[model samples]
Target: MEAGNATSAAVLQARELVKRFGGREALRGIDFEAAAGELVAVIGPNGAGKTTLLSILAGISRPDGGEVHVPQGEVGWVPQQAALYRRLTVEENLMLFARLEKHEDPRASTEQMLELTGLTERRGEIVARLSGGNQQRINIAIGLLARPSVLLLDEPSVGLDPRQRARLWEFVSALASEGGTTVIFSTHDIQEAERYGGRLLVLADGEALFDGSADGLREAVRREAPEAADQDFETAFVAFLHHRGH
Candidate 1:
C-alpha cells in the first residue's frame, strides 16, 4: 500500500500483483511493467483477468497484495465503458478535468485536447449527442488532461467498426511513436492486439502465459507447435493460447 515512487525507473510496474473479489481471485501474483514510450497490449479471454489487471495498474482498484510504481499524476485510464457526463459537451467534459487537475489554462488545455481527438467541430455537442466513436475520443482526451506518463485502456475499440478501429489504432500508434507516451491497453481481440501492439502480454486464468514482442510470441508458439510457426500472428496466438490451456 505504499503509493509508490512516482519517479521510478519504469513509468509503471506491478510486482507480485494479486487481487480478489470475495471467493474468486481476479489476478494471481502477476508481475508486470511498462517503460516510458512503450505500447503494450494485454490479451486474454472473457474471464482471464485483463480488466482486473488494468484497473489495478491504473490505481482505480488496489491489489490485495503487491507493489505498483507509478509517477505522481494519476495513470490515464479509458475504461471499457464510457466515463463521461453524457449531458456535458465534448469541450465541457475536457474543461472539467482540466480545472480539476488545475491546469495553468483550462481552456487552452481543453482546446488542445479537442484538436488532438479531432473533436473541435463537435466541441459544443453534448456527449450523449455524439456517436459512440466520438464519445470514446472524449474518454481519451480526459485521460490526457493530466498528462500522465502511462495510459491504460480497456477494450478501447469496443464499439467501433473495423475502419474506425483502424483509425483509432493509427492515432494511438502515432502517440507512442511520436508523442512518447507509454500505453498499455487490454483487448479480447487477439488479431487487433497483434496488429497494433508493439509488445503483447497474454494472460490466461489470471496468469501471464506470454510476454514479448509479436515476433517473439510467434517464435514461442512455433517452438511449442511446429505447425503454427508458419502461420500468421492470429493463428500463432490462438495456438499459443491453446498451448497455455486457456
Candidate 2:
C-alpha cells in the first residue's frame, strides 16, 4: 500500500518517527497513519520496536525525531501492564480515571465503562482480586473512560486466555467499527494480526518492511519467495524476510 501522504485525512499520524537507546536505534524514520474507524495491526518480532512505536504514538515517550499529529485529549492507550490502582475497587478505579480526565460527569462515565467492559457485577470487587483477564478489561475500560477517538493497544492479549482474548477482540472490533474509533494494536501473533487487521504494518530491525492488507502481504511473499507461495503464512513470511536480507 501507498505510504500516508502529507495531505491525507488521517486522524492519527507520525512522520519519520525516530527513537534511539544508547547505541541502538529502536525506530528508524517510521511513517504511519490511521484514519477514523480503522483497525491497523503492527506485527513484528521481539525488540523490533513495536513497543517503542506504540509508546511514541501514545505520548508515553518522546521520539528522538519526527512529529506526531493527533488531537489533544483524543488518544487513549492501554499498555501491556495493568496500570490500575490495585487496592481500589473496580468502580473506584474507573471513577478516579474519569475524574482525572475531567469528564463532565465522572459518575456517568464510570457507569458506562462498567457496563461496556462487563464489569458491573464485579464493580465492588478490589482490583487486586480480579483475574488477569478481568484486570485487562478494567485497564481497557479505564482507557476508554473518556471515549477517546484513537485507542492504542500494545500486546493486549498477553497473558489472556483464549476466551478472554476473544472477548477483548470482539469489544475492540466493535469499538473501531461501530464506535468509529481508530484502533492500532501491536502483536507478535501472525494469526491474530491477519485475522483482525484491516491493514497490517510489518516491522523488522526498526524498519517498516510492508504495510497493507493480509492479501497484499501474501502476494508480496509470493513475489519475493516463489517457493513460499504454497507455504503457511509464518513460513512464507520468514522466506520473504530472508529474501529481503533481514
TM-score of each: 0.92, 0.95
Q: After the best TM-score superposition of candidate 1, give how far the Cα of residue 93 lies from its true spot, in angstroms.
A: 1.1
- The residue-by-residue lDDT of candidate 2 on 1-246, one tens digit each, is 234223256899898999999999999999998888899999988988999999999999999999999879889999899999999999999999999999999999999999999999999999999999999999999888857899999999999999999999999999999999999999999889999988889888898888888888888889889998898998888888788777
Name the lDDT of candidate 1.
0.84
Off by over 4 Å in 2: 1-8
- Residue-pair clashes per candidate: 1, 0
TM-score of 2: 0.95
Q: What lDDT score is found at residue 224 in candidate 1? A: 78
Reference-based lDDT, each prediction: 0.84, 0.90
lDDT, candidate 1, 194-218, per-residue tens:
8899888888888888777877776
Error of 2 at 108 (Å): 1.0
